[model samples]
Target: MHSFSTAVLALAASATVVLGHGHIRRVVVAGQTYPGFERWANTDQSNDVTWSFTTDNEGPIEAANVNTADIICHQNAKNAPKSVPVAAGSSLQVVRFNTQGGFEHPGPEMHYLASCGDSGCANVEKTSLRFFKIYEKGLVKGGMADDPDWNMQKWATTEVHKNVQPEGEGFIDTYTVHIPADIKPGNYVLRHEVMGLHRAHLGEAEFYPQCVNLEISGSGSQQPNGVNPMEMYHASDPGVALDIWVDLESYKIPGPAVSSVASKRDIESSPTLKTHARDIKHWLSKFMA
Candidate 1:
């Protein structure tokens, strides 16, 4: 069996040719980073903390499958075995690994949280978990006369890509979401997703959904009810079947509304992209040696 580091190195090497599709490589909470499930590598997930998927490719579920259980996370996703502790009212960064370039699709990004009751999130029935929206960012600005490129720069995906070094040459980018401050402390599943509307006009919008097990710590007392994943979206939803190539006046984010108790924060106006090529090269040298 290949070691974890070897698997990562192999995946990194292959990333140079893959395009469009991506997945969560890791997550950052309270300044500590936790590894995310690499669906394509090291499939012995007995010790994985992130939800598991059946496929090795980093692909998205089609909008046609929005009502299916696959939309709950990804394709044939299984519950994670462990939960990471996170403080309420703190930021959680979902770091993505884009295969060859920046996120090539234009879309909205969202975050949801579902409490796992007392038994915890590791093995809970996914369909029974009710998810309340904690964060949702759609089109920032566009459909104006003077603006060219359809204001793509203001898109949520664009903002995420800003985290990649050299604009479009790097493989890593991040999206930030905040845990609601008033939510009751307990085990919860953090569902982070992005919808690629580049081909939405053809009813082929792409949905990339991922889940993480979180054990929240706080002194709050609120457990808001939420919609089930199966009922959260529809094929004909305005946001799910829109045309971004044309002049769109605005966009309606798909799914349930953001919970009243959800925390809100401003995005960084100027984000710095840190380079990781040198580090990857160093690891490759050792592996080759």
Candidate 2:
């Protein structure tokens, strides 16, 4: 009986790893926090239209599958409806959670945006979407607190690290990116991704990516071009199949370089804006629950 119970417990733990990894469950837009995949799955899009709800598991994608079609937007984001409305020049904060615990993975965080039409979220083909990077957070010097640049990230410095510390007991989870004010008005999808390096020692880096649908309102005409979805990252890319445990100081960030079409200072200087980048406590209360 003891052996049987042990087997049963093992099976349950495996199931949780397969079905309950992590996902973006909350987003903050203009200081208002809105429920993401979790809440939307029950109330707004009950039919499992969003990939976050219908995916077989929230487990991280294996590095070998980085080039597969699944890499485009992960499981079922293609048909997910645009669930949120955001304005240009606004800072959007994405919050991720694990079913078993808080974010426990350690690696870089990335944010990308793709333009679709006014109602394009309801029916977007993965291939038809092109993405441009708006925010990225990579490891600092040696990833140790003693390192001079320890808390100084190469990108997304203020927003991503505001809630969590790098390599802390809990996963450094929250990330923020600004919607370019110069972007043309339309519906867009925000693609957020986190690369987990805990298992990178085995050449099996894990990728957690989710797409958030939104309607963006703004006035600018510079639509940025992006690489083909299939060509975004290669399985052999240093960033994809890496061993983060070995190299502490010489790690190079994987994937395409960050591209921004707007100046970040503009967001902070807008006369009508009430809060700027240093508003750390704004998003803390919402995620406390």
Candidate 3:
């Protein structure tokens, strides 16, 4: 049980060998950029203690610390009290940064959501937080030649995973996810993360997680049935200590599966919805052409 301070000190001591790390700069909702850790920590209130430390201390959590308190949000930034208001069901984009170069880590990307108590964002407990998958992306093979399109469908019905280009280039990366329309209106935490398996062959997996606080407002009333956040993964879990070079197909994304209250019964009841969705895509393609 490594304390947050212990993890920070260890990370600082080995800062020289830390491959790369970054945080969510800001979240875009309805095309509006809201102040997140990066914005608040860099502004006139840069001296604010909660967010300031993140500017220099942002990075990946060691694979073995997945169960530590720091696992809640990278480096246990629990005191960084900041939350942005958003409408339920609104389109949301989490903007991420790739420290050294482009996103060179090859593995799946994922997003999870959890609710906080009425005591407000400031009093939310990280261990009490339970999350259900909202989005995930894994490898998708297209044609026989080299690379294939990995872009997912507009909205989501389950957890997803996608592949990161081994030779991609860029400092900034963006991933899209939506607030469950039926989600209860309240405060929540959006955990945006990526698991880099490049060094997994050596039994080391790197997790880059950035958490954003959000106050959602809408007519929705359903709550997510999620798993205990702390128990989501274990240090010795196959997914956490993996060998990406071998057994690629056997790899499974960590944490509980996505369970959208609104979509479950509907998707299950209307079998033709899948066909209709496919038809809509086909028609849209023809219309665009």
Candidate 4:
């Protein structure tokens, strides 16, 4: 399972509203959480549970000196490194996306929403698009092959990223939700929703989910720090260098590729590889064009 770790901050409000696909199709999308309501109790609570990740950046990367990020997180099961466990008062794993501030001011803030959306349930918390992609697209497999819906993300974050985080300005965001004195203890999925726009009327700017998970217990169940809980983020861009062999070489692609094969080096630089540097340049040029 892919996970992240960070400490808890204070909780103030619950993020609200629905994604307004305009159609309430019961397509079973997971990881969409909002404040006030959460779909509590895992009646089935499948231990058969498995986790996967996807990000804008899914490749070999160094932890310093870069900014253009990949945000994508499918560190494959084999590719995923074993990290410390998440518990109350320890460094918890949280996957977050930086709001480019392309949208309007006071956008949706980032929060560690519990496991359900209001429409989805009364006791559950909000979920994330990252998690949704996992459900809808299936574990981002096959050597950095891009998910078709990866395109949907452009519509949400791109516009808002303009005003807030901009090319240089540091992004400011807020997350909503509390563990509630009654929240059950155990490993639960949490989202790190980040935003700058607040006006619900200006489209769905306030509802995007840039999130991660948590294993809450003890003090973790208490109210979090209102904002900025000592977070350290990494660019999701795959172009950055790294130390791990797979991370440094095999971008975040999972499984094998098309009816073909090659040496490890060849696999790392295949024709289909989603090289982040190339992706950024191509995308930038296309935008400029």
Candidate 5:
């Protein structure tokens, strides 16, 4: 009896650790889903576009490290060796994994793009990359209520499999962003980030950033100016350090304004688009040709 009780307690503790954090599981480009680096497995992903991280456990780069290179991606991030072809003005989906639940932290999601130039993003210098904000969403509705949908977390991190029972089956959440139609074709690094501000009032905002290599193909020729990734946010920035628990009128998202060339979608009215893998493959072949 004593041993069984100990085993149950141990299982609960393990479950807590797994449910505490989340990571990217895969990315869908032009309807084709590419697997993200499996940090938990630490497997070889030489052909994958998502950058690899050193640790198996998913964690955030604290706000204190905002000025460091670790903030650009996660800790000890390695650039991907390949880039995936994505057409301009197409939707890119990022699927997140939490094992048994949705992303519990409330915050905003922001996407940036850094041109890798003629050399490409596969081996580009991490510090030399200049990133411009392409998309940002925060505080969909302003109010002082406990309504989950009104908060940024619901807008960006809601659970997709709420009906799945037995806990850990299909715990996935998806966020989509469209490539700007007018941007020039080139190799670019897509930086997708989510800021968890639950502890911001306590001076410990969390940043989860991941990078993907993309070869954009299009005839558009507008390249927006970018800022150094390290300079994108400061510890004291109003958006970086703020309390979301109290009655709030509005919340500002950190970083530069959305680029002029970005494909703007209305979060309030736009329905989440879904695509078939077969159709995506057909379209991609013609687009690349």
Candidate 6:
């Protein structure tokens, strides 16, 4: 049987990318990386990982790696949930982003702006439900547009939110994002929002807005000149992608032993580490049709 690769799918030429899910357990981990990130928890993505869970209406579960998550948290302990000491009823305010996944984005496309309070302020109304607007390309509005790139442009909800969940140890939020799956490879912001919170005891409502970025990339690529793998899969799988790879150990295409892409070939006839070319035309034809 011909071998194949089962690793995470990449539709770009780059090796790595990120998403902004700011799984911040602490606040200080948001603004920028420095000493503050070292105190409570390590924002270092050395170990912790993320997976995929989505459906047509609820869940289309898949164990795929996703872009990291970013959050708008308080800068005290590096994304820690445990509460810190406050001045009996004092005030603390700051703006920051906590990165959770892997995409290295340029920056947030939108911010949490409050209409009743102005730029960075919020209303202390009786029931603190706030209004928000989505900003894109430099235009501030409430809708989305299709970019020349196939990637998705804005937030799309399949079902209206009937209810909001109460806070757990900290803020508990959820969202439904729609990715075109054909957008240009790199980190792109998928979701952002401004939410209101009211402390009945203190009579203060805090707005915590958050954003999430996405990363789309190709598994690997080679120089010389050929079709972009990502483009081949932009709309349809387009059958098998064509590629040239040098294999020294013809017994197996080099990579992790488990990589299904590993192929067993005869070294004597093919030569070691020779740049051999092949095409996944079989798979491409189906998509083309």
Top-lDDT candidate index: 1
Give the alpha carbon lDDT tens digit for every residue of 1-289 in model 2.
2345334433333333322256676677877766665542437644332345445556777788877767767755455644567888888777766544444455677778888654487677777888887665555434222111224312232234346533323243566667887878787777877776555655666777788877788788767887666677776776666543332443445676666675654222221122222244567755685
lDDT of each: 0.74, 0.59, 0.58, 0.25, 0.72, 0.21
Model 5 misplaced stretches (Cα beyond 4 Å): 1-20, 145-155, 158-170, 266-289
Q: What CA RMSD would candidate 4 show?
A: 19.8
Instruction: Put down candidate 4 lDDT per residue, 1-289, tens digits, no spaces.
Output: 1112100100101131221111000111124321111013244322211122332221221223112122221122111111112334333222222233222222212223233222222222221221211110111122211112222222122223332322333232222233333333444444333332222122222222222334445543323222111122333322112111111213232211311111122122332244556678899999999
Query: In terms of lDDT, which candidate is stronger, 4 or 6?
Result: 4
Q: In angstroms, how far off is 145's CA in candidate 5?
A: 5.0
Answer with 3 or 5, whichever has the higher TM-score: 5
Better of 1 and 5 by lDDT: 1
The lowest-lDDT stretch of 10 consecutive residues in candidate 3 is: 141-150
Which pairs of residues collide in model 1? none
TM-score versus the correct structure, for each prediction: 0.79, 0.70, 0.69, 0.25, 0.79, 0.21
Return whichever of 1 and 4 wins on TM-score. Answer: 1
The best candidate in terms of TM-score: 1
lDDT of 5 by residue, 1-289 (tens): 2245334433433333334266677788867888787765667777777887765567778889999998887788888887778989887888777764656566678899999877779879889889988888765544442423333224343232232223355466677778888889999999988876666766778888989888999999988989999998999999888765554445668888888887647232211122244457889999999
lDDT of 3 at 135: 66
Which of 5 and 6 is the better model by TM-score?
5
Where in model 1 is the C-alpha error above 4 Å?
1-18, 43-47, 144-153, 166-170, 264-289
Q: Across residues 1-289, which tens digit of lDDT does each residue of candidate 6 receive?
A: 2123211111121232222223322222223221112223445633211111121211111111111111221211121112222221121122222332211121112222111122111112212212122221111111222211212212111111112233433322233222222223332222232221111112221122232222324332211112211121111111111111111112121111111111122011221223232234655777799
Ranking by TM-score: 1, 5, 2, 3, 4, 6
Model 6 scores what on Cα lDDT?
A: 0.21
The RMSD of every model to the true structure, in order and in angstroms, is 15.4, 13.0, 11.5, 19.8, 13.6, 22.7
Better of 3 and 5 by lDDT: 5
Window of ten residues with lowest summed lDDT in model 4: 5-14
Higher-scoring candidate on TM-score, 4 or 6 = 4
